[model samples]
Target: MPEQGKKNTLIVIVGPTAIGKTALAVALAQHFSTEIISADSRQFFREMEIGTAKPSAEELAAAPHHFINSHSVHTLFSTGDFENEVLKLTEELFKVHSNLIMVGGSGLYIDAVCNGLDILPDTDLNIREQLNQQLAEEGIGAIQAQLQAADPEYYAKVDQSNPQRLIRGLEFFLSTGNKFSGYMTNSKKERPFHIVKIGLNTDRTILYERINHRVDLMMQAGLLDEVKGLESYRHLNALKTVGYAELFDYLDGNIQLPDAIALIKQNTRRFAKRQLTWFRRDGQIHWYEPDQLTAVITDLESSLL
Candidate 1:
């Protein structure tokens, strides 16, 4: 335990997909004799295990984990909801553990927990529905063009292929007549616990190879059948992710299975690139090769001490 006057520490493990964040987090949690909070937004839904690459049952048993497969895909859990729940969980966990581990590749979710999110005004539902319709009819390019015209700053930084993000940006512009990026205060919120961010990375070629292998493994683990089971809920926002979306296209007869699998690998690589781009902007993160477990532990101990 930390000294009575010392604040609890949140050791955050951030990295791209298939980068071994789960194994690292579990190792760190065991080292600290503490628990873990998963900040990976995709893993929150219970139905998404195979595609989301959720920790194995053995891994979950190795260290107590929170937020992994905790919610149903039918539920609409937003980043704001995550922020509130994680803040409460962290406060409660800190009373027992001096150091806690948080691991995920979701940059926005991690940002919400580290620095409070700016509460934008409620967008008009009509505008959101219209944008969604436009996305379905005219495709992502139409929304991308609109966002580029309205909020070039956010457009440049956002994943242009994601309809939800583009819609949100365009909705904010239409509703408030201001760029979505303008609403982001970017101010770090004071937390009761101290935060130490650790980022894992590797050569791009190696990372892409890992992603490809992971996708192949997911297929072997029945990701296609898992996606087929959720066909009824394909329109849900929760299903609008790289793996699921690509598979859905296959099920829709829009692409061949092989092509869909290839697209999954390509899109996942792109998503990893975007995640790195987002994390790179945060200068506080200490970067290390994914396999440098001992060094990460040593650095973390130095911070705690």
Candidate 2:
């Protein structure tokens, strides 16, 4: 594999939301007799389950899984922390399994683990407090405009709905006289183990339908109650995600329940589009439909031979 004494290989399965990434990852893990390391940012919090679409109990029992729903919402975790933890865990997993599977739809988190993100300078908490005050008084549109003026390229790609993303870009711009996007140049980093990337894709219409249906199912499984339970922590950065954000509006009487549900579906679709854009930028990834598992697995085995 690549050369002599390459150690164990890492199989990374990545795709957009509702692309059946979890199922394929589990299947591949079973085939390889290995455990899974989750890269999902939202799925890290223990309280966020149904909305994050975490792996089911049966699936978790089928293959040993790590890092899913294992953190407290109160604890702040950065991509740098994730990169450190996953790298350490991957080395440990190598002791037992020759091939370890890592999977998720969170493109940035995956990038952090595989290709180290740029370390931005820390921001002043007082400045952060002032920015939060501005966000509260002026709303997201005001912050969006600020970020766009500072880093239009990042504004195009960053999650506009997430205030944390905006704060990060602005913090860097205000502190360093340079856009945060400038620091994130995405130069590849060296890793000790071999990494094999497998991408999953499907027809746009089909993927959208799956997303809509999954949102409906989340509702059926009491996603509204799940959000309601976390209402006390709604302001937490960890809880500020697509499904929970829309439902939070419904909880606050800002929107009708049905409208909030519809908005969740719409936002989820847009998120899928962004995920595709991020993943497509990596030319090293070998793409395939979900149904191409047999051929994909065959190629993976051949690569290690």
Candidate 3:
């Protein structure tokens, strides 16, 4: 018997990329007769199909989903925007179903939905302009080193290759003289629905192998063509992602095709490692092997029933 209020549950499935989160989310959605909200930032764009490792057509057809191709690459969808839209969507969905599932490897997006985002002090536009100028002139290493010296904790978890993130952190420190990591505290907002977090993982060697194999599959499935299609949009923040970025460098004649492909695999593996680092800091999530669907269901049933 569930409590009077707080009966609805948001089942959050999170883990490293290529950890079979989509498969588990679809299965759980089928069992609960519910829908899935994607937190994968890259999958929100229609242009990034193969590179994002989105659910296949069959898997998407298996469950109704939200926020998949819901935005254009040209638009900016910040974490705060995601949190607002998801909260509204969850409120509507709970009227029809008692359980809902949200799945992704993007830790900040997932956290924004579940626990609310940490409110940071306002940053100056001038600082942002300066940081962007520095990035253009001195390259990402300059910004990365600044963040590493100022906020090593966030530096360890953030995507280092993403100049946008590095610049944002540095800008915060410059404007407020506060470490970006210090602003991240447990200032959670109350949600009407209860949340149960689930995580999937395997040994490092196996997970790395899975990431490598997924990259190879993406390449075979015309990931290059997808990048080429978005060549004009390469400067957009959306196109500056893992697989896309490496291929863009290849197209720029800065790297060979084989080297780019290899770098994509290597960078993806590193991204997965950072994802794991970010998720592991949260102690509330229950862990499981990707194949442990039965166990996940049993635990959810016991918690929600």
Return the top candidate by TM-score: 3
Clashes in model 1: which pairs? none
lDDT of 1 by residue, 1-305 (tens): 55698888999999888999999999999998999999998899998879899999999999999999899988878889999999999888888898999999988889899998997888898999999998779877799898999899888767665678779889999998988998774577888888999999999999999999999999999999999999998877778778898899899999999999999999898888988888998899999998899999998888899
Which pairs clash (backbone N, Cα, C closer than 3 Å) in model 3?
Answer: none
Q: Candidate 1 regions off by >4 Å?
A: none
Comparing 2 and 3 on lDDT, the stronger one: 3
Q: How far is 283's C-alpha from truth in model 1 (Å)?
A: 0.5
Weakest lDDT window of 10 consecutive positions for candidate 1 = 156-165
Steric clash pairs (candidate 2)? none
Query: How many clashes in candidate 2?
Result: 0
Best-first order by TM-score: 3, 1, 2
lDDT of 1 at 114: 91
- Model 3 off-target regions past 4 Å? 1-6
Q: 217, model 3: CA deviation in Å?
A: 0.5
Model 3 agreement with the true structure over 1-305: per-residue lDDT tens digits: 23356588999999999999999999999998889999998899987899989899999999999999899998988889999999999889888888899999888899888888888889999989888888768867788899999999889988887777778888898899988887765688888988999999999999999999999899899999989999999877777779999999999999999999999999999999999999999899999999899999999999987
TM-score, candidate 1, is 0.96
